[model samples]
Target chain A: MATPVYSGAARTPQRGRPRDASRDDALRQAALEVMAEVGYRALTMDAVAARARAGKATIYRRWESKLDLVIDTCTQLAQQNLTEPDTGSLAGDLREFLSAFAAFLSGPIGKAAQALVGELPHEPELASAFRETFLTAQRGVLRRILERAEERGELRQDAPRGMAVEIAGAALIYRLMLTGDPLDLPFVDRVVDQVLVPLVAKGQ
Target chain B: MATPVYSGAARTPQRGRPRDASRDDALRQAALEVMAEVGYRALTMDAVAARARAGKATIYRRWESKLDLVIDTCTQLAQQNLTEPDTGSLAGDLREFLSAFAAFLSGPIGKAAQALVGELPHEPELASAFRETFLTAQRGVLRRILERAEERGELRQDAPRGMAVEIAGAALIYRLMLTGDPLDLPFVDRVVDQVLVPLVAKGQ
Candidate 1:
């Protein structure tokens, strides 16, 4: 399993009583649910507080703005959901990782992630935070998987390792964000066997 | 050149003084420019009219709402930009097609497309129009390219042809939306040689 790398390292110093971990998690989860349902434009701190059964002041105390809360929520979600699979072969590892990824995209965080992509070009701060935390962590999972395959000599030395990682999960994302297609296991397997396997695994 | 497939076939019947072709084109171009600058959420019919130097009534006479206007704008953009390349080989076809595609994504319509992606899930009308018009037309171009390769005996009989089209342009979309990276020829070439070639071209 991939370890959670984000530890709130960039968070501003808290001024009040120490933050409650459980409450923070609940608020973040609620924020994601709201975002998944209504999208970022309609999301507000009041809605998040209402969904979390917490006070608006409580949310303000922890995060400066709704965008901050969302960034924190997505970062936490990435840390929790990302896992490294050692399935011994490149194809096996890709299958495992992509299946898990497909399932993640089918959930609330996945929908919320789509909600964020449209705004990234406009919101530089959120864009940087997303790339730095969630995207970096997700890429690291695939990078390690590819590196292990290279070590086993199951991949060509000149294999497009970086591009493979980028392309691997892209089908599911393209489906989710663009086509609005359901992400299924069969589709995941096809991408693994037909796309990732051919592109990265040694000796086509 | 890929023929302009969309000819406003889906546009609602206009019920005013005969619409001006040059004026409508100006309105759509203005809509794209405003969207690229302010994003979908901030776009307004009045703003589009102002940018196009047309009256608000002129804008509404052509389209029912701002969303309707955007949908029309994107459809026109797709028709104007998509070109089918005949380079006698899949690699050459993809290279030409992708370079044109990369250039398209670097412009105003490209920015508007990203702005719309965030709202696709929330707006079923826009989603269906996007899928039916812009997305379908794009897939058709790639599908033709792959089918040509198959006919020439360059691709395996069962070479994941549909998946090839899906995966081929995914890296560019991934970078433009997720990573906030610059899309350049070198990156485009890397995707072609490193990923697309190995995935689709027979015998690696």
Candidate 2:
């Protein structure tokens, strides 16, 4: 079993009180706009504060650093936009998951992720938390969906092969991060049918 | 078909005589050392020149910017390390290719790539050339190997599915770039046997 390395060192908590919902919304929207405009390297907390019309102290109370702010903005976006659909079968469950996944990748959070990715290697805390806070949350959704389909006997006994489970997600990430390609509905369908469906479906 | 978009904008060739082989080797090696030491963002052309004991002109004459130099060093490393294996079976060929791929990812060039990936989206010219110069070259090798497998009846005629052709490479990349997981031979073997072999083998 590949032990999940959920390192806690990365998620350095904010020093002040928890963020209010509307304030949080304004700050994150500002973060995304700044990220898209300036790219990650040039993106600064001051600029985000300026853009959002929030005081610098308000931004700091929520996030410790620019890296934290960006990561939080993305995390908030994921929680807001992400949902798992139960379509009664493994294929449909996955199609629903991927459709939502593709849309997420095309939206604001996805753009933030792309911009922030280059900094991941240099920032250990950000990298670890990103996997746990963001990527793991998404994977957990997929895992539950797969488990349900298996219970219904719609999938192979050895379905959701450990690392192979990542093929769809990994391929999608590869297209976005490395290859600089677009992710769309048709691309999602092909991965599900050609790769995931063929590999995991029962009595194929 | 995805048209090959090879814009000449990124690779602004130097207006100079051909670089000497030994000097080029020293500069590239120095680039790797500086990258490993300071990472991509901090790496500078002046630093590379100082480290390699070469003039700043020598470095600039060869590369337009630090991004160009880094990409070129990675490209050269890929050409040097990349090789095709006639392993006679799709499984064997994939195994051989992945082993080499794993080894490369664990090496100096791999380290450089890890360091540079975060900057891809911000650097359009570098991103485009990276797809063309580094990634496309590797994929071509895999494609030829797969085509041979299909010809020998070892694979389904449409064996290497369109997007799924990326599963192996993408999985490996996702592990490295996103998840911060190690890409070892055993990891490589599981993806081949479980995900890839099952997905494409004839009579599955």
Task: Kindly give the number of clashing pairs for every candidate.
Answer: 2, 1
- Which docking band does candidate 2 fall into? medium
| Residue-level lDDT tens digits of model 1 in B1-204 | 455545653755568577788888999889988988887767899999999998998898889888788888887776677668888898888888887788788765677777787667767887888788777777888888888988887886567777877876667777778887777788888877877766677777
lDDT of 2 by residue, A57-172 (tens): 88887778877777777776766666667778778878877877788787766667776766677668768767777787767877877788778987777775555467867978
Task: List residue ranges in candidate 1 displaced over 4 A.
Answer: A1-18, B1-9, B12-19
lDDT of 2 at A115: 69
> Which whole-number lDDT from 0 to 100 does residue A5 have in model 2?
23
Error of 2 at B3 (Å): 27
**Residue B129 of model 2: what lDDT?**
71
Candidate 2, DockQ to 2 decimals? 0.61
